[model samples]
Target: MIRTKSFLSLLLLTALLSLQLTTRAEDGYRLWQRYDQLPSKNHLKQYRQSLGEVMVQGSSPTLTVVKEELQTALGGLLGQPVTITENSRKKEILVAGTPASSALIKGLNLEADLQKVGKEGYVLVSKKAGGKKYTVIAANTDLGVLYGSFHLLRLLQTQQDISNLQVSNSPKVQHRILNHWDNLDRTVERGYAGFSLWDWHKLPQYIDQRYLDYARANASIGINGTVLTNVNANSLVLTPDYLRKVKALADTFRPYGIRVYLTARFSSPIEIGKLKTADPLNPEVIAWWKNKVDEIYRYIPDFGGFLVKANSEGQPGPQNYNRSHADGANLLAQALAPKGGIVMWRAFVYDNNVPEDRAKQAYTEFKPLDGTFKQNVMVQVKNGAIDFQPREPFHPLFGAMPKTPLMMEFQITQEYLGQGTNLAYLAPMFKETLAADTYANGKGSTVAKVIDGSLHNYSLTGMAGVSNIGNDRNWTSHPFGQANWYAFGRLAWDHSLTSEEIAEEWIKMTFSHDPGFVAQVKNMMMGSRETVVNYMTPLGLHHIMGWDHHYGPGPWIKDKPRADWTSVYYHRATEKGIGFDRTKTGSNALAQYAPDIQAQWGNPATCPEEFLLWFHHLPWDYKTKSGRTLWNELCYRYSGGVDSVRAMQKTWNTQQGKVDKERFKQVQMLLTMQEQDAKMWRDACLLYFQTFSKRPIPQELEKPANTLEYYMSLDPKFVPGI
Candidate 1:
């Protein structure tokens, strides 16, 4: 009896401790939604005085999100109770709206101009109204008001002065989506975070607070769309049972202006509708898709349309029906057109039968069908021609597809780059790809302009990132991974925002507002992506991760089914030299680029060192402008990456007291892990590549402690998304 009582006491204590630790994990699943206490007491007090009472004059599902979010965020930041009053005659009040719902806003002459701002745009102004000075956040619709509410809170959270603020904001791109490669069974493809947040089994019955929180987080960043299932799809999602579950999530996210998208299995007509041939040109197949889409829209009126992965990597597509990609994409676009939906057709296609370079496949496949796609169809191209490698030249399709709308697809999940274990800030990489000159129209044709439709004059434009989100307490598995999510949103909303600005904003919102802390952390964040690229894929080397798992080095990967699929095919390092030659003399892939870019990159001496190995195959003895031979420069770059990571570690250590203990420690541990992995990458790559160079390691750098073979053998078998 005595022992039983002691055991019960111990169990209770353990549960309480677990709960406390969970509350303090600082893992980042809450993302920017942390709503942490404001660092400036004066600013906090000032904001509280001006925005203490949130007078929500309207009630809608979206307004509910706004009110609840305001109350929760304000209470956390102010450390005081905040009330949502029905009456707004009080001195200090926050009036939010649509004119129909908010009389005070209507009286302010906002309704006349609200129509111009549209449903998702907002106008926030500080003015004198009805004998009292008040801050007003108004919009044409409740969704816009909700967005405005979050925008106002964001400014306050970052400790910015709102005394004379007059801000009008709308997304540059209409669709900002996070593509979840989640299976119905809750397994996420290439996901390093926890299990899928969409608990399909329990959802549509029990609406988890996690779902609400997910909507809030996405809304805060202006990510207005989410595709909840894997692009490598299953047809069952079109069934009535799954449609009910999808509607529940759509209803929850509606107020936040987030629409749910689903992956449409091309073979669904055959599988679910009992049709023999699921051909895009087939009248029966086309008719079946129309009916299915009609059913989906009936359930989810604001349903974001289908994302299709056809005839690629074993999934069924247009090729099975002897139809072009346009045929497959347009059929669905036609179906969803009446409902005002759009089709996002994936351009990630390759086949074992095609003996051409894997990097050339996507460009070849989509180049011919440039103007063939319907107006509502967007051809989604991966950031690189190949899969999401650590470093890849911007896809050739970015420049080649001038007549069609092409959406940029970036992977935020770190599938090939270190997953959740390695600390890699991806903003620099994103900026690099976006800023690359595609040179389609002229010298200034950049990938950013292409996706934003400035270069091609496309009406339908978007940017999609494969999400890293899951059920982890911090959202993304690694704490720093949140920065990628934040960066993607900032870039998606305004591609013009620099990486430095994005990093600083994220640092202030996620960590500390102290000037020194922000400055120091921003430097680390800016350099982190390049550091990973250098250690992992320096000098334009690409796709060398272990087969399947893709965790660590696999420079020796060969003997795969397809020659192009092997890592050895890309690097092409032998006794003579390295790099795949894509120049006019070689594959003539250089012809795809505008002549000016071709002139700059075609010549080895003038080509940027960052992409030298991508376009040119230089001899080991070739002298670089750095006064180092090609081989020595490669070794130096690999070592430099490791050194940069160490510098990031030192900088983070100095920031210990400035950030919360739990979060600081979490980042420190991740950085420490990064150091070890960076070294592993530096050593293994140099040692393996050195065998072909037959050169000595730079004397100043430390040599690998282990043999090349030993490093190859010491593999972590548990790497996810293999």
Candidate 2:
């Protein structure tokens, strides 16, 4: 009797502790939509009064979700159950819907407003009608109403005054999407967080709640499309069995206005259809693709389309038969066009075998084929000429491909920027690329204008982010990585939003609305990308990371299979100088850009110091704009990066009690790791580069803890995201 009584007590105690831990822990699964409660009771009272009764005025799948989301969010935020009300003529009722669904919304005459914001946009206003004031969320479509609901919730979450709300908004770009690099085997390529989110074997039968939550989070941020597979795709996904599974996901996400896309393997005809050649010009190949697409549409009526990676990185392409990238892309485009689907053909191709600079290859291949692509095809270009580096000049393809709709492909994954462990907020990096002056048509031709279809007047426009999401409980491994994902969606919707503004908004919604916490965290996030660059690859240094894993500094890396894959090809850090020469005297990569830019950047003296070593090979003793020798500036930048990280640690440590203990401690520990890593990057790169520069470390900077030989000898195994 005593033993049984003791067991029962222990069980009861365990359950209570579990409940408390769950309730108290902020694991970041909710992402930026963490709507726990208003910080101030007076603020909560005002919100409750403004949102007296909630009414999403429709019965469609999308509006139903809108209702449920509002109910849950409002209930948690207000500390009471949301009341929709039984009264027919209630005043101050928060209503949301399209004009066709509600007579009250129709009577408000929102035609002009609705037309201005477009089909996917909404008008949120507070109006007086029939001696009653009502806060209305009106749009022309149910999806728009859903978007408005999220925006209103954001206002509430951030504790803004919504009593006199008048907001009109729309996504700047069409087809705002996420490109997951997840493969069929449940392993994500360059996925630092965990396994793939899609459980292929169990997917069609059992729908994970994570799928629903994922769609909800994306819908809240106006991301409408998701390419489900890796760009280096497998043909098995095109099989009938997998199509059924994809259909299940499509059905689940349809309610939240998120369409599903898949990456089409170029050799599907050869692999899946048993054809001899996967040539784009082959009739059998063409017919096979058409039939496969037809079958996919039967399963998923609203399939977005395909993202293709061909003729790059050993991927099969039409080039096997001497056809251009356009031919390979058009093969898929022809099949998708009739169904109102589009092809996002990637422009990340490079024939590294060519005796030319890698940065110039993509432009040479795609520039001449600008007007040749099918109208339904969008040429997806990376932000930088090289891979997702810490910083690089904007791709020459952006403004150059005016006749074709160029889609911006930004990496939200931190593959090149410390992966999952480091706290590197990427909004500043994204904004830097977006704000680059392309000088395509004139001085005002920014990359943002070219992408949103304002520069060249292309009919179709899109922006794709390489998703950092994984099956981790936090979605993204690092808690702050969620901020990068949030920033990508926010900027994809509106490029005009400043990075600082996005950081502030994310901080307020995700962590705390307290002025000091938000301000301090925002400041830290705003400078994080620069700090990482300063430490890792400052002043035009590029692609010097460790071989295969790219985890640590590998400035001595050479003799890789391809010359471009080696650090030696980019930096060219000889005994006399350090930096690549891409000027007229060297590879002439500058010729790909506009004449104005070429004239400015081609000359080493005129180039911005940030890109000084990128375009010009300078001697170690060359005087920088700051009057320091090139070697000293490089040393200072590396040390400054380490110092900035320590400052961020100090900033984060002061907020221990301001947020949840779980997330606070999580960030604190991660910051410590970051500080240590920053030191490693500084020491390794400076020590190795010093061997060539033959310069002493500055008096103020800390000396490296180990010799260059010791640093070179150390090779970390089991690096994630290889």
RMSD of each: 5.0, 4.1
- Where model 1 places Cα greater than 4 Å from the true spot, the runs are 1-27, 110-116
Backbone Cα, N, C clashes tallied per candidate: 6, 0
Candidate 2 lDDT over residue span 596-643, tens digit each: 999999988899989999999999999999999999999999999999
Candidate 2 Cα deviation (angstroms), residue 28: 1.2
Q: Write the per-residue lDDT of candidate 1 for residues 677-713, one digit (tens) a residue.
A: 8888889989999999999998999898789998888
Best by TM-score: 2
Q: Model 2: which ten-residue window has the lowest total lDDT? A: 83-92
lDDT of each: 0.86, 0.91
**Candidate 1 displacement at residue 227 in angstroms:** 0.6
Worst lDDT run of 10 residues, candidate 1, spans: 21-30
